[model samples]
Target chain A: MKKPDTAKQMTIARLLLQGNEACVKGALAAGCRFYAGYPITPASEIMEAMARDLPRAGGSFIQMEDEIASLGAVLGASLTGAKSMTATSGPGFSLMQEHIGYACMAEIPCVIVDVMRGGPSTGLPTQGAQGDVMQARWGTHGDHPIIVLAPSSVYDFYELTIQAFNLSERYRTPVIMLADEAVAHVRESIVLPEAGKVAIEDRAGPTVPPEWYIPYADPGSGIPPMPRFGDGYRYNVTGLTHDVRGYPTTRKDEVEPLISRLFSKISKDIDRLQWFDSYYTEDALVTVIAYGSVARAGLQAVKEARIKGMKAGLVKLKVLWPFMRQTIDAVMGNSSRILVPEMNMGQLSREVKRVNRGNCEVMTLNKYDGTLITPLEILRKLEEIYPC
Target chain B: MLETAHPIHKYLRSSKKFPHIWCAGCGSGIFMNALIRAIDRSGLAKDDIVLVSGIGCSSRLPIYVDFNTVHTTHGRALTFATGIKLANPALKVITIMGDGDAVSIGGNHFIHAARRNVEIASFIINNQIYGMTGGQCSPTTPHGVKTVSSPYGNAENNFDICALAEAAGASFVGRSTVYHTPLLDRLIDKALDKKGFSMVEVISQCVTHGSRWMGLNSPVDMMKWLKEHSLTVEKAKGLGETERKDKIIIGIMADLDRPTYNEEYDRFTR
Candidate 1:
């Protein structure tokens, strides 16, 4: 096959796109050929875009009966060698938690988009909150491993969504893109990445023939090569803790290694998984740490603090799960105080304190009234911490 | 002379861990026997068949079958089958669910799958009790029957599985008891060839838990009860409604030509 000129496709055009719209574009670019979702506020735009565009690109789109079935379909399609995804919000996310655990236990590669909205049960459908950070970590039952990514802008939404698929496929696990309503609905101008410039990852397929293949054999990579259905592998996939052959087993010898491998596969690669963007933290006394839309406010707050001759910097986390501890410790080493601001009752702030190392005074600014934290509020916390 | 093995043995997984979990005389084993025979008769390639199931004793059937199998979460097998069928329309997808797994927790998915008329063969093994989680009353449990959950008596009315499937717009619907194994095999064989959603409600026995509650002492007694209560659809058509009360109508209920979801989707997209 002749290689098409990627340079012509790289003719960059700046266009205004909503974060959710950008997410759909990224999914399609990442070879996501299957999407099954039920409409939920703020996240509905992502589903709508997929429904309109997936079929034209020779992909499939389905609107499931509810969120549970939506995630079920996504997992099912993923097993058939398709990059599949589903988009939903808080209430819907809660419904999908069971299947999320199934995907984790079964080691299926799929992406889930949860647009954060005010919750505890439909608290603020139209408004955004960062309340689901902890839920994203522990929503599914058991100590199974998961990867979550957050985006701060429309551009980040596009890039991180593609990254989410890559991580899930490479790791053979579920990856969640946890975007808040603010980021999902916000429109911004971004120059689309050139076709060849963006990297896409497909799930590794089995190298051996069907007779010799063990469906869950780790083979030293901490991940087994996956086989698609109808590929003559005829292997079984179950949610049960199974042996390498994929039959349900309760033996301690089999269960222990299976669960450990699930965690070790990601923990061994924690350095690459802990993605963040730090700004002006070289010689700062007070550092602001945040993610999603709150990070945008943190950046603005640090900028104002810098202008006022205060040593302040920002660390915006792009990957939220496998919790960015090493990065937080590095930030804490240089800064005497850290202000963790979020649109929830201090979910991520708890993580910051857990890894504080007692060198810095870790403080939190939590707003749970279904609104984003403003830069001024963060600045006030910084002033209080510095006592200037 | 070499004696040939049973035809069904060829379809059993080489790695199948058996001394199967089902209690002695559980109807799921009977259904599995009939299913393999039916598949053997149909002559479909094992590689092209995908078997999906939800959580229950019946759902465990997929692990023993030599095909692409997925044992999914409770009450979500149809959704998974829907995805698999759409992702590869050429693959024959079949979902095996139990009473609670199908009509109770997975009721919404069940009806929608039928309504979409997706090309899938869904079999609901209605033993009328939650066998795996102990003998709890299920959605198809007879009203006023005693169960662990319904110690006094079942307060809820039972669902008519065949009627529900037909009402939900399934292209093919059938009902047969484990006693009628040959008919069950034939019905399942026909369902496999259906181009859209097809379902067979198997009124099988749950001798361990369900029989204890129903006052049936043994598997033979339960089989006798099924034989006495079930009437072929043609036989029941001549009987009055009063006479047909509580009778399990057996045989094909509906078969119609409809535009399947996968076919319609492919036509428009291609």
Candidate 2:
């Protein structure tokens, strides 16, 4: 196949695209061929782009009836061996939890893009909030591990989507790209990578014969080779905790091994899974921890604080799950205090404190009014504590 | 000779699991038997077919079948079947669901799958009531019928599943009752041969739930009631609107050809 030139293509060059559009481009660039989604606010553009582009790109696009069916189709399409994805906001994401758990337990590879909006219920349909940070980690019933990537900028929206698909395919679990309204709607100049320039990861397929292939058989790497349906390999997959053959079983011996692998697969590979960008961390007195849209405000605050001659730094988390405790601890170990700002009521702050273990004083700046936390607001909180 | 000649009965036993999960005189078992007979006659390898079902008494049919089967959550059987079919378009995927399972909780999946024209045989056992959940009014329950949830009588008009399937773009749509065993069997045979979305809405009788709640006492009585009340689509066409009012139409409602979702998807991917 001739590699298409992407670097020289700058038709509009400055054509306005939302963060959601960047996500679509990223998914398409990452080899997403199947998109199943139900339209929801602040996230619908991702579906719209897929609908428009998938057909032309020789891919499939389905507008499912609701969020549950959307995720259901996505999981179904992934099993067919297509790189599948679905985008939704809060309520839709909530409905997708059960299937998300199924994806986790069954080890299905798929991408779920959640454009965070204000919620508990239909709290703010068109607004932005980061309240689902914890839910993304533990919303589904049962013990399972997941990878969540938070993208702060429109550029990260493109990059994180590719990472999300790669992580999902590599780990054989659902990976979430958590974006908020600010990030989702924000338009910025982003240089699109030529098609072959970016790395695309496909799920590992079964190398053994049908009889030798156990769908969930531990390859000792914690992830088994996933065989797509219609490959003449007969294997059963169930949502219930099951044995290696994918048959449902309640045996204690079988259950422990399966659950342990589910955790270890990601935990052991945490280095490749953790993604963060630290700014001016050397000799910093205070570290500000944040993710998604709030990280933008935190970065700006750090920049402003630096002008005032304060030794404040930013620890922006791109990979929010697997906690990245080692990196977080390493970054904050020298700092006397850390300021964790988020849209929710101190969810990630609690995580910071838990990981810090009283080594540093942790302070939280929470705003739940469906608006972006301003850089000035974070700077004021930092000044109140550090008093520079 | 004919009694001992059926190939399905040879592979299947008449023992305890023989009579199956359906109540004696329930049409579901008769339809199930027809499905087995069609499969046996199709000459497809048993290992090549996978039967999937959602939550319902009818959904339990796949569990009893010796072939590879999946008993999934209510209404999501088609989604799982789609997964299996897409992974291997060569695998003959069949999904069995009930009225509430296919149309109520799973209605969105049903219409979308049909619209996509996914290549799978979808067998919907429309027993009128939520049989497993103790006779709640279902999407197909007759208007003004009183059930546990509709003590004041169901005010909602039921979905015409055949119409819904046809409108949603299913390549094949057929309706039959347990009374017409031969026709149901023939339809199943055709559906198995058809390459796109083939839906067979078997107007089954939920004797335990519908009979007790609707004041129809026994399975035989319910079967008799279905025979008396149901009208063939052709027969209904000849009758006036008033005469055909509240009548159930049984026959192949619509049949057309459309590219199956998987086939189109495969062409794209390939």
Candidate 3:
């Protein structure tokens, strides 16, 4: 077993790792004991790494028949109180949305790693595209409070996967580590955290006895303490519209509260749940809203635009869903236009438009040829939006 | 009334959740009752048994019982059950599925799970048609059966589920109809006790839809049909080939001793 390097006394050295490899190392560090996956391009490396490493750390892995079964197993392991996860891209990710809804409605805390690939039907298996940005938020039908975290760099890939697990546990919701193919396959040297330096928070256990405990009871925090299966509670968990006691119900009064709670749980805590970084938008005339790999180019364009005396700034989204509206408000509030560059035809820009609410022009620099948006393209778009 | 209700109520959820959604003549309730009695008979700790079911009348068994249950998506109960068993080997995981769930949309998972021989019990409610979706022809719908999806006749041949499970390497396999309550309950008990990927294919009757279309509309008729059509394996062995062609051979089809996946996993990780 690898010793915890995050301990203050331990000296940690930098390791060169692909984003996929870093994700496995981070998940293991977060106490993930079960991994269920189905192989798909660009994301399959994560499965391979997890299969090799998770078993060594006393964890288990299963290559399920399909993505639906993969997430199903992940949720089952989670019900037994194991930190579990699965990795997929494109078609496989689409297969998982049904159970992702189950995880949300059942309030199962597990991580889903979507290593974004080009799609609309296996369009480009090896290519990176942020087409799933909107899908991550609204793909699973019905009103659901969802969390999607995007990582732009190798270090962010490592750190965000851990963050995904922590947020999922804390909120009792499935967290999406939305890394693009670029992030998953890109290799970079990063300073690995020493063991114990990274904080690990497991899901809270029920304090009350089985008799008094209601499985879905929310004492206004909108988060209920979960009892692991076989811990003597004998409570129930299902996909049905259930009551506080976890029994099926058809009452409108009961249905509204359960459905409302599902959305309100995260919407109420947007401050703690939302995370992003903004640059120079306070004084700029235009801000480019970007996330995932496109955000890397957005940051570069912002710097280059600034050197050439164009008041160009960037808001790189680290947390995509339950989107940081206030963050965009801070960045685009002072600007005349917000330039949204992405591999998809403006998926996230639509959300920016919804949240920005005509406060500024939400123009998009769209690319869908199975390639990353170059810094030059973003810079050119920024110049066109607000010529210096 | 309260005293008498307590015995059955102890195995079920609150009264408000009852008058269960099951139709009047369905045999799924019988299967559910047998499952509950078998658990009670085995004296297994209630908290240690997790019931995971897929969508359908059969999958709704977990909705009535008071165990730690999850009524999952259509056709994926075994996948979830596999996870629960692998996560905590001490817990007894059981998956409740319909014929459509186990043999059609979920066939890959059904076969893979049996092949792995994971220590989880699966109960397949074979009602010969898709009961949930308005009596459509299912993968296990009998040959030449007429229904909404197959109004003329079912072109597909039914899957002999016990043979499929045994072929897929399930360590224990059994088949019994709801009419044979004692034997069906015993089948469930032995399957649960086998310590591997054990399965009991219960020949449940869906009276409202498929069975009604097949002319077995009432509960009495469905039960009688099941009893008359199915022969005990002992009796089946004596019959001539032509005489046994239409009978459902019933009994523990396979029971063998082999190392279970749970113990093997522990050893490999250790």
Candidate 4:
């Protein structure tokens, strides 16, 4: 049966969709026309939703042989100028690491939604953990820049999916949507954006003639305009470090320019990529840092601490990668102590400590038992940090 | 503009991309020449056709062709080809892979594409060894053949490339060797014309690496050996096991009527 135009059929301006369902809706609204994925826990709902809804929206969905091919297919679709995505967790993410690296190297625009599960290799399939935070950045080999975004609630899940597509298209690289099991499986009410209101972006195609089109050249911006394969540009594409003409080259000097462009394209625009929510950190003595589901608890702890007439606050990152020093500076400006409560044993905490530069006491309250660190635990830690 | 009228020169980017990485006397060059002829013979628009190849000497075919091409990671060409086909069914996609690339590291994607009957032609150049990686023993390396990876002679059984594809439910499966250049081109053109998943296995040679090690050192010796070892399907049929043993049956292994993936998918979506 065909899924009706859900946006038009809605009774209210809101949708009570699960985080995973919201991800699909957001992708649909954001102009994703191709999705290829292999089923994995805490992430399979995306595949299910796409399987049911993508066709109705004139999109394509395929269950690939494995996670590697899932992303390979997604990249393939992206090459044809079709917005593409895939979702996986744990081992599947591990399998996709190399292909993700390929996407970064080739500068193919696509989205990857990774619903975090307890890992290190299938440590816990059904449980939540922000353990993949580091993997999202450095899982793939080599030194390539990446854009990663985390959605804490069902609403952010929907919002971030749209943002993920927009960023991917604009930047001409794969964007990772980082959501833990707590966020992806959570059910919440969200006032969905009006139909045709969500902003969408498309990758620039070659304006030059077929012979003049260089696949990897600087198209004014550091990023090159990528033409769809059948659009007659007929330019060569490779995953190896290449010259602006897109032919493989091993010349050391040429490698410098190719890699530098890959990094500078993202780093130079770090501010635009930087996104986070700052709550009461202006004058607070104690600051909490969290993301994904942990941020939800961190938010509660901030409110509870404020209720007790204490100077406490939080900084939750919506965009994780292209980690900005400005974000850390803003979060730590007035706070004497920084508390990082995470599902993993401190993936983001380590980065926070490094960026904090020993300016203040940065503490990591970590959980690794495939469970969410509750707000009560966060509050208790805060109390211990400052008695009475 | 008149130069582009030549069918072979139209698809083959020999002018700008010459001195290919293939070794002197390597059959991969022959197979690529035949493939271009096949593309020209298929009569598809150049813009609507794409060549995707994984890492290997055989996979380097796309680098020498002017069509929309993708030189992907090793063994991943099939998935990339499938991606291109699925994304735009209006476009025609083809993959160039080596023995190791198509059935070894890329075994899963190969069989699945056949099983799913995805609309794409897979032209596997079975050079019997990892030509680029220095004559290493590959999945298609014949048993008892000595190579770097199989110094004491390989114990692994070789895959019958066409048989495996036919068993996997491919709609079109054909086999020919570099010696049969015209016949090989015809097979590729026929496979490309088929609706669903199709495969054309070209028995290529790695003259630099595999030839000396496998005792076919010279071009003449290799050509002679290829001609002797592989027999026509019609000639080999009904022969005794002793007569047919070690003989590579080269002909149409399978051709069946089947609905393509895009067709089924479009119907379901509608």
Best by DockQ: 1
Say which prediction, candidate 3 or candidate 4, comes out ahead on TM-score: 4
- For model 2, residues A262-304, the per-residue Cα lDDT tens digits are 9999999987766899997887889898999889999899999
| Chain B of candidate 2 vs. true chain B, TM | 0.92
List pairs with backbone clashes in candidate 3. A4-A195, A5-A194, A5-A195, A6-A194, A6-A195, A6-A197, A7-A195
Instruction: Return whichever of 3 and 4 wins on lDDT.
Output: 3
How many clashes does each candidate structure show, in the order listed? 0, 4, 7, 0
| Residue-wise C-alpha lDDT for candidate 4, range A64-112, written one tens digit per residue | 9999999999988888989999999989999999899999988999999
Query: Lowest lDDT 10-mer window, candidate 2 chain B?
Result: B10-19
lDDT over C-alpha atoms for residue A241 of model 2: 81
Each candidate's interface RMSD: 0.9, 4.4, 1.3, 1.2
lDDT of 1 by residue, B1-270 (tens): 876588767888878677778988889989999999889889899999999999999999999988999999999999899889878888999999999999999999999999999999999999999999989999999899888999899999999988999999999999999999988988999899999999999999999888877798899999999999999999999999999998889999999999999888888777
Q: Which stretches of candidate 3 lie above 4 Å from their native place?
A: A1-10, B1-9, B14-16, B238-240
DockQ, computed on Cα atoms, for candidate 4: 0.73
lDDT score of model 4?
A: 0.87
For the second chain, the TM-scores of the candidates in order are 0.97, 0.92, 0.96, 0.95
Task: Rate residue A41 of model 4 by lDDT.
Answer: 95
What TM-score, to 2 decimal places, does chain A of model 4 have? 0.96
The top-ranked prediction according to lDDT is 1
Comparing candidate 1 with candidate 4, which one achieves the higher TM-score?
A: 1
Q: Model 4 off-target regions past 4 Å?
A: A1-11, B1-6, B14-18
lDDT per residue for candidate 3 within B1-270, as digits (tens), equals: 436553456788763456778898788888888888788878888899999999888888887887889899888999999889888888989999999999898999999999889988899999888887799988878888789998898888889999999999999999999999989989998987887899999998888786656686578888898889999988888889999976889998899888887778767767
DockQ of 2: 0.29
The digit string of per-residue lDDT tens for model 1 on A1-388 reads: 9997788646766789999999999999899999999999979999999999999988899999999999999988888888999999999999999999999999999999999999889889999999899999999999988899999999999999999999999999999999999999999999988787898998889999999999988889899999899999999999999999999999999999999999999999998877999999999888998999999999999999899889999999998998989999899899988888999988999999998779889888989898788999988888888735
In model 4, residue pairs whose N, Cα or C atoms come closer than 3 Å (at least 3 residues apart or on different chains), thus clashing, are none
Q: Residue A379: error of model 1 in Å?
A: 1.8
